[model samples]
Target: MSTVLETRNLTKSFGEVKAAKSLNVGIGKGEVVGVIGSNGAGKTTFINMVTGYLAPTEGDILFDGQSVVGRLPRDITRLGMARSFQVAQLFPKFTVLDNVIAALVAAEGTKASFFGPFTTAARRKKAEAVLEEFGVANYSRSLVSTVPQGARKLVDIAMALISNPSMLLLDEPTSGVSIEEKFPLMDTVMNAVKKHGVTVLFVEHDMEIVARYVSRILAFYSGEIISDGPPQEVLRDPKVQELVIGHHLDISILGDAT
Candidate 1:
């Protein structure tokens, strides 16, 4: 249960608006935690800060027992932390295999060889292997824009995981996926991450998805965490029910799911 990630009084503000306020939490090694909230509830803001996409206005972020306060996103990734966005981050015009190869280059921190021979046979084999691992090998030769949303998501996550990070943060992992595709998408992701023994923190609006995958939940409102604990406990809390879940989820059914 050693902590892999921690935030101490973390705060982020844009002008007079405070997007995240005095946040504090600890995620242990190999824990799969879910972050839930209404729109603009600071979930993404917290993710951005932790991943170094946005620097905190005050306080600190510690990853693997060291302060990462002023580090850049690439530096954080190199330190064994990686994240996938709410929107799949991929090159639309590139084939899935090529995109993965590009990600591999970035993960290796090698200078891009734009003028000549960027994709070596070794790189292609590795990229194909990663694509196969993520269950997106069928789309390897397809342009990313032509692939289904679920497959695109898998590729984006595959790119993030190419560096073999110890901790993986996913922002709205199932967003834009159809109802029929959600469970299968998450199943693939959870299985792959579990195989890698990576700690996971994901932001999601789908209650069913959250209830099914996460061992613990953090509910946010007005830029603050109102409840944090096991899914059963957090989902049943009066404050969390009113502010976060609202009419979207029926808590009684979720008792057995978590």
Candidate 2:
């Protein structure tokens, strides 16, 4: 597959601390890649820089071969890249449908006013379609704060997908979800993204989830990528096991899950 995203010598530093080191990585089109790291690792920093949430102290980022280093987050979104946070970013007070309508308005690059009617019938129908696309239509009229955690995650992902992005960066998609719900939640997300042929880069801590969903793994240690390869190979790497995974796991079992 052709390269969809590339970071060349990417570096981000906050004063004396290096959140991201001189990193170079490339993600191919339609690849499902998992990012794993400990607390101080640069996983989130990498996502932030790529998504334009943080300016890189050095180096460049390219989305589909175009430099997005200095682009605004919305501008990057307009370029067909979208991201969901570890904590679902949603309008807590808005009805789920209304939340999606707001996203649709922003995706269209139209200025949305507090007093204006942003939700036309066509927009509402589109929002409903998005809700159904992620299997969250059942919560269409419910407040975002009142839904289950899994539903909230789906709602956030649905909002991201409404923009029809070619590449989606998901920050810990299964965080705060119960174990029984994690697989189903990931299944829903993977299915939706695959339907759109979207490339995915997700930060995940769960070994099973990472092994099951991603074709490749990127393991970060202290702001640097220490391992990058197929899931089984990276998972079984002794250094990765000691520093990241923190214990030996039978890759055969994880492979079976995949």
Candidate 3:
């Protein structure tokens, strides 16, 4: 498989603290990879740097074989890379359909104005289609804040995908979703992404979710990757079990589940 994204000696620092240290990794086109780490383990920092939300103190990011370091997030989005936040980033007051229409406007790179005639009938039709694809069409008339967390997350992912990005980075996609809802939500997301053939890198705290969704895993610990391999191999690594998974997950059970 060809590489879709790569980082070389990526580093980020806040004064004396290094949130991400010399990180180097590559994601293949169409690969579904999961990122696992505890809080402050540099997972978000890695995503932030890759998406241009935070300028790395050192190293380069390549997207679709072009250097993207120092590029703005909007520029990166235009380059076929888009991301969703850990918390669903949405306009709480706007109805779900309107939020999607707004994303469509942003994706077109047209300056949005309160008095501008941006939301044409074509835009509304496209937004509704996207909502239906993500299985959130029922919540279209509801305010985002009034929707369930899982639905809100689906909306956020849909917005990221509005630009037809080749790569989608999801930060803690299952976080805040109820346990019963997590699998179905992810199934919708995974099925949609697979249909579009988009590469995925998601940060997840749920072991079961990670195990089921990703073909490979990157285990992060203290600003570095402790293990990188197939889910079973990485989860079974002693270093990963000791440092990342810790006492919370039993490796044997995870092994059987996979």
> What residue pairs clash in candidate 1, if any at all?
none
Task: TM-score for candidate 2, please give it.
Answer: 0.97
Q: For each candidate, what TM-score against the reference?
A: 0.96, 0.97, 0.96
Clashing pairs in 2: none
Evaluated at residue 60, the lDDT of candidate 1 is 95
Weakest 10 consecutive residues of candidate 2 by summed lDDT: 249-258
What tens-digit string does per-residue lDDT give for candidate 1 at 1-258? Answer: 899999999999999999999999999999999999999899889999999999999999999999999999999999999999999989898999999988888888988885666899999998898899888999999999999999999999999988899999999999999999999989999999999999999999988888899999999998999999998888888898888878667765686555
Quality of model 1 by C-alpha lDDT: 0.92
**Error at 249, model 1, angstroms:** 1.4
Q: On residues 1-258, what C-alpha lDDT tens digit does candidate 3 reach at each position?
A: 999999999999999999999999999999999999989999999999999999999999999899999999999998999899988889999999999998888888888784678679999998999999999999999999999889999999999998899999999898899989999999999999999999999999888888888999999998999899889888888898888888777555455443
RMSD value for candidate 1: 1.2
lDDT of 1 at 243: 88
Q: Across residues 163-249, which tens digit of lDDT does each residue of candidate 2 receive? A: 999999999999999999999999999999999999999999988899999999999999999999988788888989999988656
193, model 1: CA deviation in Å? 0.4
Question: What TM-score number comes out for model 1?
Answer: 0.96
What is residue 143's positional error in candidate 3, in angstroms? 1.6
User: What's the lDDT for residue 120 in model 1?
Assistant: 95
